[model samples]
Target: MLQSYETLRQTGIATVRAQIRSGGYASHTAGLGRNLLQANLAIIPQEFALDFMRFCQRNPKPCPLIGASDTGNPILFTLGQDIDIRTDVPAYNIYRNGQLVQSVTEIGDLWTDDLVAFALGCSFTFEHALIEAGFELWHIANNVTVPMYRSSLETVPAGPFRGPTVVSMRMIPEERVEEAVAISARFPLAHGSPVHVGDPAAIGISDLSAPDWGDSVPQPAGHTPVFWACGVTPQAVIQQAALPLLITHKPGHMLITDVPDTAEIPIITNKNMPR
Candidate 1:
């Protein structure tokens, strides 16, 4: 059976997708894709697509839209030639009426032709940039998932989608904070720079040792927990909407896309985005 991220590290995107499709690797995808851009998956019906897209528009920091699919289509032509929303991800979370129903490795049976998949920009590339610049990510080094928290920061609501902005924390040393910001700023789709720095209490995060999602990471001696607007924010917001059906990538198990981190994607902002 296929195993760890390391085992699939050398494989290409197609191979990795195939591995996940086989249900042989349902694991956290923190450091696997190298320089490849990763995306958070949100599959909803066409009936909710317009509102959801507007939600992503009003709240770009957490719900940065990168790629999207048409109604009744599983293929995100921009992300990959053969990307399928139903089985490309390592794991999926099913929600009904704003409550989690179950987690599945694949959504083949739950998929409907009316579903539209949205691929939002994720921070894997930003984390990669940090590592390339000599900043160490504790979760990546320790082989655990990054710590994520549901912050007190409210998102700009669009229709039924409204929730606190979720953030992922990385412990950065005192001196490297500026350097981290500069590197991350280049990737606007990666949620821009650090949303919050130092003192988790300011953001209403009560505990550094306890995260709302993913594994808890220790706060090293001189390092401070720097929070970034996570792509998981949309999933959190969608859950509260209590839609009849909502499907999302299991937290930390993102969909690895073929797009390179350095690729110059179109500057898409503002609510006037073309459908």
Candidate 2:
């Protein structure tokens, strides 16, 4: 039998991935594997790999490419020795011709020889930092996914990948906003700092209650809504490109990597990457 969510939280990173692979857990990965590096995943055809890489390069803040699997490879040796892109993520969002068609726990049947997998830095990597620094993350405290929105900020275009940037929001206590910013700024691979600090409307997000992705959290008194550049930007770009097929980690459902959040992973890696 699968362990309960609370019990699983006390387990190791590999155990969490094992549970996810076995269909024992298929939910958001926010607080799981705490302080361990987590990644946003995007798997597409090898033909578009170069352009996609360029897109990530052009928009490092929103699309910090942590690692990319070798063409047609399902195993991400750099991220984790046994991290199989096909079934490691908790859940996957299937995009067909740029439209999200389905959500599944695993994509083993859809894995193909022509596919290329890319792992981008995710904001969840910094949540532990904040919590350790004594900041209360409303979403996590309430057992909900952080609220994410489609912002008016445009990303640098690269080939067919061009779209508005996506931003994740967290309600930070007003006085400690600066401290929160300073702490998060250290993790460049994990979306270093706050892109917008105040009003949601200034960035084209009109409603705090309705986010484009993830669950919304209530704004507590004396807290301000802070926004950060998110890795999910690729999904928006993929939608605009109208690609024939694309697979991505379902919003907030990430690939839990063996790498510690403190480690800085290069944009690309080979078999030599340290475990």
Give lDDT per model, in order: 0.85, 0.89
Q: Candidate 2, residue 15: CA error in Å? A: 1.3
Predicted structure 2, TM vs. truth: 0.96
* Best candidate (score: lDDT): 2
Q: Per-residue lDDT tens digits of candidate 2, residues 17-119? A: 8899999998888878988788899899999999999999999999988889988889888777678888899899999998889999989899889999999
Taking every candidate in turn, the Cα RMSD to the unseen true structure, in Å, is: 4.0, 2.0
Q: Where is the poorest 10-residue window by lDDT in model 1?
A: 266-275
Give lDDT tens digits, candidate 1, residues 1-275: 67677777766777788888888888877777778788998998789999999999998889889898888877676776667778888899999888998999988888788999999988887888888888878888887788899999999989889989999999889888888888988887778888999989999999978899989977778887889999999999888888889999999899888778776672333332323
The parts of candidate 2 lying over 4 Å away from their true place are: 266-275
Give the Cα error of residue 176 in candidate 1, in Å: 0.6
